[model samples]
Target chain A: MQALVIVAHGSHLNPDSSAPTHAHADTIRSTGAFDEVKTGFWKEEPSLREVLRTVESEEVFVIPLFVSEGYFTEQVIPRELRLDGWDVSAWDSDGLSADTATLVAEDTGQTVHYCGPVGTHEAMTDVLVRRAETVTGDPEVGDGFGLAVVGHGTERNENSAKAIEYHAERVRAMDRFEEVQALYMDEEPEVDDVTEYFESEDVVVVPLFIADGFHTQEDIPEDMGLTDDYRTGYDVPSEVDGHRIWYAGAVGTEGLMADVILERAADAGADIESAIATVREATRKTEADGEPGKTDTDREPRETDTDGETQAAGD
Target chain B: MTDVQATAVDVRDEQVDALLKRLGSNDGPIEFDGLSAATDADGYALSTPESGDHRGLSEAEFRAAATEDGVAPYVTNWHYWEETVGHRGRHRRAFLRRAEAADERSVPARYVDLDSGMETEWGEVVVTATLGENGDRRYEIRHADDVGAAEDELDGYDDPLDARQIATDDDRGRYRPLKSAPTLISGWIFENLGGRDAVETLDVLYPASVANWNLEREDELDVTHWRETAERQTGIYDIIEDLPREAVEWVAEACCVDSQCLKRREWQYDEGDDLAADNGAGAFPCREPCSLVVAAARKWTKLEEEETHTYEFELTPSEKEQVEAIVDAVADGRIDEIREADVYEGANRYRTRFLRAKRFDEDGSLSGTPTDPTDEN
Candidate 1:
């Protein structure tokens, strides 16, 4: 059985930050398409190192549940999981030789597969559009309405801003609103700057963030000079100077995120038969040099190891 | 009783005579001028006999001062009253009486608009008062516009004492509740991470353990076991468990080995080196890794309980595709960035996908591996 572990950047402060990831993990696990579906966080309990230790699967796929391809996705998760030069030869079940195995190895062989962040999947565009529409009530390309896609952009990673730009471009292509633009909290063409970019008199500001925390509440409003009473009604315009702006809640608030996550899993390698076939082929090649009739591919009988010291079958 | 009465009467005559002389000399209208002169002279403005200030003076004296002497005479000759009461007494009394009747009565309320005053829906009002119940006493208040309007709306009572109480009560009611963000966040950390003691330990040791630095104290010759024990109890592991996953990841990235500030130590194996002889030499190299393990365990346990569950496995290819499409859209930032045409497309896609996934088998029979994912399960 295969296992997928979705790792998230949790918070020591805000429970809402980790809530969506946890919900998505539940959805994946409930489907029961894999042997295991777990979640791990960097800040909260179950530290990255502990997650590697606790993961029992011989072959576990790690998926970063982040919004961008930043430091955590690029450097931190890999380091924590010790993915460098790790080998999985001992855990291989199909009696395959080392040369025939497709598994990558390090000096100290530990087996693990690290996938790209779930945020990098193509399906996230739907979430952004849906959120924008729900907030602005105009999901079509036309005159009068404006869309501002706001992201938590930092100076640390230029690629992080790409997710926002990608979504903005897609939105602009649809031409549903009179205008669609991308903005950030940190980088240039900030949320305030994008306010001027919109062609329409009215704009809907949607935060492409996972939680309704400081950035969404304090920073965004501070930059925009929003008073406490602003954005009380969905249709009513939040007047800044003469321009009317409306705000939607953060993108993470959408309930359909669970579906999105499951869809990502399917897109990654969800076809059970295909995945099994691939593993089998790899196992067979590795086993070609071993004893002819002795294949380790068969599932072990339930009660063979009475001493509770069962050895893993080698491929 | 006779001795007490004689003393009270004498005090009342003396006070009334002085006040009458002050009022007789003042120039303004009787009500306004008398009070103003009395306030200007003695710093002891007179209210109706029912006022709290009335109780401060001898009853006989207050009665005589207000009735027999009358208010107008005091208004006319206010300086004489000031001479009798003392230099600052008149100003103090004026402010106190104004503060007392600010809600119910239209007394000339003394106020100072400060920069840090409150903000109200209506207009702002700033009030500062110096009280002299028996002698000279003072208190200051600066309210926001909303509070000022609220204060203005209060009903005026006939008695000054009742008016004072009413004003005080209104002021208290108008005070905004203290912002609870800090307390709420702290409490959340404490409750989630076991308790205050556990949280305190984590706060202390988190920097040292996560950053791989030794903590130094001013008093100790060397770091002792008790301090170590404290640090261990409050380790980064415990701190992480209290946090949500995203915060954990952010902090770890900011502080751990991958951080910009981290100093990487390269290992060189020499012949006959026992350190290099063991395959597990680098395992648990520092407290940082151990703390990380603890943090990961807590996070894992939490996620296991929150995420994994049983469901039936009966989804059509189309349904699965729809789900996959939605997921892809989210991952690629398409759904999150849907524009005019894409908005409808994204919504339709999400709706179909969500419905299909929500329609798992009624029996709750999951098709994947046998291991129960959730600890509760």
Candidate 2:
């Protein structure tokens, strides 16, 4: 059986942090691409340490639904997931090639392919560009709009700003937008002074974040002077300090993310065809049985050593 | 000793088929935990015992339905429960079995309720479990206040994470510092969550109540006594360790009691030195001094630094007892229970207001004696 595990940094304080991950998992599950689709959280239940244990699949693809490859992708996740032979120090030099790197559990023998964070994917450029144009209801955002790709930067990890910068450069290369700039919540050219970084009066700020929580909903908007009260709904193209700002939702919450996750798995050397085929076969067999739950698989009897020790489903 | 031992994976299908065979021959519908299975002329049916309603499936359908995604619910839920409450060198399997009422119940004797519908409480949240059409466990979490409220009358949430919002604040829109505080607002329900999702919902509502309860039941709870917990404090909290031994009991009485927090206080002055205050009667145990208690202790430590003073004040005997009663009422969170019409109740808002009006002077002093010598009043 093939399984997909989507890992995200869930919050103990804010429940919304894990919303996008669960949404994407539901979407992926509906497609029936894998035998099982489960979610793991760094902060919530079914934690990274135990998420793999829940899956009975032999072949598993684990994707990090993060906005960037940084301390989490480099260190915490590997340690928690117990990905054997992962050199934390080799992340930059070795590039941590997702396709070549296969994590096989010492005990479970589950062949796990750990994929890259979805944020750094090439498809994210499309998502960011799409968000910028759609939020303004202007396909011609390239004509006058200045795009600011915002990230929650930290002094702790230099790699945190790489994804935003990469997307900004990609958008700039497209030459669609008048100007594209990388902004951060904590670093210089911060989201607070977003208007200063753009020459165009029409500025579009897109948060390159996985979850639409406190930073995207409250702090960034408050800093941009778009909304005084975070509780009340704010409109797009809100007049902030005499500048027309169209603030899109977090990039991670995009519907296209479900497709991006599948792409990431494929790129990481996951046998997508085999996974899909397994699920399809089971579904087909169930359908052929003239009912949803019926299958034609043969059942072998018990081996009987300690058969009377405990009840079914017991330890 | 190279004995051939077949793994669970190798024997899962056989076990499921064996259980299905037994289910087919049952004299009538047999119920275990929340699951009910029986055979009829058409096929076999597995459903919730409480509802006793389900669409029957053929033998093939029953076997196929038992396993979701090539992983049997029995296996998945077994490993899930074992990892959840059985890890960390703890032994609450018996308690968990009893909680789900799976103890002494076997497959031939009865079918394993993989996702059994059970009702349990974690602090102020009432968790109700039921079975789905396919015999999957579904859970509904709501405030204890809305226990009997109709579904339409209360707001409904499908996402288990929505419990965070409901658990964050009280009915009055005030932030609750304690997640397990009795002030949880009502009128919201997280309906029809899966087994794992239900546990996650409960965790969001009350953090580690289930895990802590399991640890307590296993007698593996690690309780950090007052001195040990306090001595490790730094900065502003370091003063907590300087508090007199007797004052530690006051902190427990004020902060660790059942009326203040839901967790039963297991910590004491030290290992063997017990506090005079009552440890709470909560279903879960408090393993250590919580951050709230530590913060409160810091404030009390500062207050305890003040020297005692004697001031002369003329007050009637009944008035003195009324003053004490007012403090007691507020401390016990029973001020809302006192009605204005109950004039005789010392803590009644109107009665207290009248007392203040009569006793307080222009400077807001009690009976014209300054309420505090340090203050201008």
Candidate 3:
């Protein structure tokens, strides 16, 4: 049996940050695309190496649920997987691209197909479009609202900004927004400056992040003055200067990305029917993995000695 | 209640302009006049009742004199608004009554802009705007009666230098003005931090712990997220690995201060350094809250449930350097070169085990011997 493993940057403080990642994993698992689907994280347990070891299948797929091809993808995740390979000399000064699943597979010596980050996929724009519509209900209604696509752009790399700018352009092309602008928390053309681009009474700022982690949940909304009370991903509409700002869930957490996950898995030769349509057509948004019950780990066998003990996701 | 009773709403200085604009739209842009020094002083008191003899006492002065919370004096900015048409006492009483009748949230009150020229049920009104000590805007309500011996004689010291000197203490980190506001969660109260204690006192720990003045997230983010994010922002790695899991809770239960200045590892002269200087740097349970201490506390819960991999190596400093270089290369994507180049038996072995970073198998082999990779299975 083949397997699929997804890597996410989990949070110790906020349970909601990693909830979407686990939810999407469960969604893909239902499709039975691979022999098994496992989720690993930098912060939370079942660590990456643990995920690789515990998968019953020898052939596995490692998918990064990341926003862009940055440090975590290039350096941290590869190092964690031992993908740069065993021969110490084989690992050199220049690290591999984390998004390049092919290179990671070659170095790790595992029968794994590495997939591109979910954020870089053509299908993600659809997820973002849907996230905006969930808040405004219709594209025409969104036209009266300024769409501020907030991204975490680093001054060190321009690629991160390019990815966000790409989405803003695509969304703008659809003409659903009265005004479309790209803003960053770290870089210039900041989210604070987003208001300058709009004279509209209403603005819908959709955070283009992979999960409901730090930036999406707090920083973006606080900077934009979108809400006083912010949960992990979704927040109710807040009023500022008579302008209504509808805060949406992260684009990465959209169920459509699960199809993107399977597509990436399929591209990497996970023998399963490709459900690309699910990603394209997926509209139902969720703040939870399934329902508000005990986590899968709590019910499923709580990891054996061979595998690390599994705890619940929120913990 | 008498028409002379005073009230306050803890609002952010930035929001005050819009709030003022909203409250005084009927009076046009209010023409402000007040006594406050612009030099070495920064404060803003928006409005006060124009009825009394000493009506010019800034809101800061009133709060300073009345409260036991040790309120800070130097407010960078603030906003105050009072009635012009109706008697100040009756209007405030009516507003409070109306607010209590409708929504009972200490009223993030929305003032109706009664046109100055026209007389409504309330009465004829005039609203004036002025700049405060810190250059923050202030609005005054001056109605039909020209009370208090002309505008210049009372609180109307247009030039800050002309106003009577008011006493202000070392209140830099204190969010004093909003301490007495009926509403618990005001943007100004949360946004303007009086260290960690003030924020944490209201039981908003998550926001306080994660508050980063440098990142501009302090006003908004609670204590919950500070630790999860500290490692990245501070570039201080191994926060969990370096500190033991069991001790994280003890600090919070023990000598934990509200401001969290104690746990901050970003400063060279932090509480950790001042308290217990071990590990070439001390550990948690500092006098103030800091990112390091907070991160450790947050990490403790996960650490307890974690099934971590361990790798022990007693390598020389040079050997360790080589190992880091190799790991960096592997992490950097220079795998083929390292494989083709000189493979030091020690470095290779160390690389294999360390590459696992105490996160992989306990007895996993350094040598790639012919055995099933899924031997565990």
Candidate 4:
């Protein structure tokens, strides 16, 4: 049996920060493509380390739901999920390439498959365009609207801006709208300066983000002068500086990502039939022999210090 | 790399002129409006600082004229010392401070009410004039007895209590301390203060003050400093320019963005890259994990700049279970219970299993980091 885990950057302040991640996980679970599909977050419940232990399957697929190959993807996610391309517990596992699809667990024979982030997938470009079109009404119209793909670009790294720029290019190439602009909250070609990239008065700004948190909800709208209300709460087709600005929600939250998740799972070469059989056998065994999902190894650490972050044995 | 310079200007010409004239001569209180000169120290008598002729009034005479008008809590006008340097309505300023102390216990009722009138919101009651935490008169209220106050109010019942017209601390309004005319940065010169480029960079970074101020130029004009002068005077934000660019880069570049996502914002503003780079923890503004570097550290162990060696060993199903127990034990801080833990061949591999189990890649390598500002963390 195998399980799928979707990882996201969750917020401690906004409760809705990880909602889409959880929603997508639930949507995948309903299809039963894998024995289990769990969601883990950095700042919220079910941390990556904790989620890894919940898998009863012999394999697990870890998919990052981020929009780019920046810090979290290059450094944080790999570090958190222990996907640094080496498994010292397994001989010769040290030099495996970072893009390697599979690795056998040294102790449990559990194979872990790492997949690319959902944002980097080729399918995401279309998702971004679709998100924009929702606000613009239709792309087939003769009077097309301008589109701006806004990202939380930074001065510390260039790849952050590049992700949005890449998508903006893809969206631009579609030529469905009069203009396509890639804007950032921090870096150059700022969201506030989106007017420079487009000639049309009716513009659509789609947030190229994984979640509807601060950058998507508060900062961009404020900078772009779309509306005073945060996170698309107010009416769209709102006029700003004589231009009708139509704002769309973050690209990652679209329901279409369910297909992308499955595609990533398939990219990992998960054998659904075998996993299904294994899950059935395990269930039968649990009922027949009373060998529930309990194991001494599943026990949480016993902490000497009561105040330590040591977790409970089971959630 | 050039040093970060300071652009702050010190004493302004108008302020200096005002300071000097007040200290240079006494502006006597006199009767005005075509009134005959009265022997009594009369209230409401209009007077102006008649330059040079003010030299006739003695300090004692000025005080007598001002005191006869009155001292705080009951005073109508405090223009006597208002013209003095830095100290305006000194008695009333002290009075407001005492009234705000919750523990002080002995304040006039009107002053106690005035304190509440300063901050936050209250119902239906109209607030004309209110003080501030600092000594800023925040509003220009028409405090005529029959001005804005309502029928049952203190005086001049018109729009609520028409408080007195005065100064303000409103940033968008005139008279904001930082937005004063001529931009009040100090001008105390410091030789070799990081030179031209440094000061220019400081000018860009510091939100206050401009650059190239010279004391010699001021002294060349035959102006003399009775007290210690400043190297450069500046608004409160001037100090930020003095910090190393990297230390304050996040502040300037920050978008108030919330995410744990890291992006490339490679800034070349490090004109002083010759200095030691900041490999230490940067700012973490996100309450939840932002895409920023610091927030990524919350859960992403790969982002953690640490060293770890990998060890792999095959374990039987039961042996794997034992490793899990040991890992769990160690994680729960129950290591003592695992004293005999290595009974399994994978016992030595427990810590390694912990990382693998925790989701690290095969190599204990956290080296996939793509871009950085200083090439340090």
TM-score sort, best first: 2, 3, 4, 1
The sequence of per-residue lDDT tens digits that candidate 3 reaches over residues A1-315 is 777888887654444556678778767766656666667766543444334543445577888887766556555566666564523233231222223344344322457565667776656676776676556555334657788787777565455676788778887898877888888877778986666767887887777777654455556666777655444223356676677777774677666778767766766666666545544444354323333221111111111111111111111
Quality class of the docking in candidate 1, CAPRI style: incorrect
For all predictions, the C-alpha RMSD in Å is 33.1, 15.1, 26.9, 31.7
In candidate 2, stretches whose alpha carbon ends up further than 4 angstroms from where it belongs are A1-87, A90-123, A138-143, A152-157, A185-187, A190-193, A199-201, A210-219, A222-235, A240-243, A256-315, B1-100, B105-377
How big is the positional error of residue B335 in model 3, measured in Å on the Cα after superposition? Answer: 51
User: For residue B190, what is the lDDT in candidate 1?
Assistant: 11
DockQ for each numbered candidate: 0.02, 0.03, 0.02, 0.01
Q: Residue B355 lDDT in model 3? A: 54
- Computed on C-alpha atoms, the DockQ of candidate 1 is 0.02
Q: Write the per-residue lDDT of candidate 1 for residues A1-315, one digit (tens) a residue.
A: 456767776654444555666666655555566776656666543455435433334566666776666556554666555566433332232211111122322311335566555454555666666555444444341367787888766564555577778777887887777788888887778886656777677877777766455566555665765545234312234677667777665666554455445555555555444433333232121223332322122111111112111001000
lDDT of 3: 0.45
Q: Tell me the deviation in Å of residue A242 in model 4.
A: 2.4
Error of 1 at A283 (Å): 38
Ranking by lDDT: 2, 3, 4, 1
Residue-level lDDT of model 2, residues A213-253, one tens digit each, is 66677778778887776665576778876788888868776
Question: Which candidate, 1 or 3, has the higher TM-score?
Answer: 3
Candidate 4, after superposition: displacement of residue B73 in Å? 93
| Retained true contacts (fraction), each candidate | 0.03, 0.00, 0.00, 0.00
